[model samples]
Target: MVLQGLTVLNQKNYEISQSIGKNLFDNINEGGFDYVISECQTCKWQIDMSSNVTCIHPLTLLCMSMDA
Candidate 1:
């Protein structure tokens, strides 16, 4: 499943962000998706840093699959 536009709260709300991040990660794992693609760089970074799932840009996926 593709999750987009995820935003991390500022430093003052770090704990809140961690809780939300954990929930997001847990949901993604439960969904059994192969990839999580997002156009937002922050979303990509967050997913990459927090989970084992492959997170990529939509354009990257399009370019890679062009020959297929």
Candidate 2:
């Protein structure tokens, strides 16, 4: 699956990909807005605000592991 972007915040405004569908939806539904956003190449994670824009790389969001 090709992942392009992810919105980890709002329901009315946010969006999630089918690749990360369950985890993303679960997080939003369960109020788990906190997430790690990163570029595809580096795989370097960063803590970001839910309002921020996240760009996903090809085959991105293969898995989203949550700590909280």
Q: What's the CA error at residue 2 for candidate 1, in Å? A: 14
- lDDT score for residue 28 of model 1: 71
Query: For model 1, what is the C-alpha lDDT against the true structure?
Result: 0.73
Question: After superposition, which runs of candidate 1 have C-alpha atoms over 4 Å from their true positions?
Answer: 1-10
Q: Give the lowest summed-lDDT range of ten residues in model 1.
A: 1-10
As for model 1, its CA RMSD to the true structure in angstroms is: 3.7
Look at candidate 1 and tell me the lDDT of residue 17. Answer: 64
Error of 1 at 15 (Å): 2.3
Alpha carbon deviation, residue 19, candidate 1 (Å): 1.1
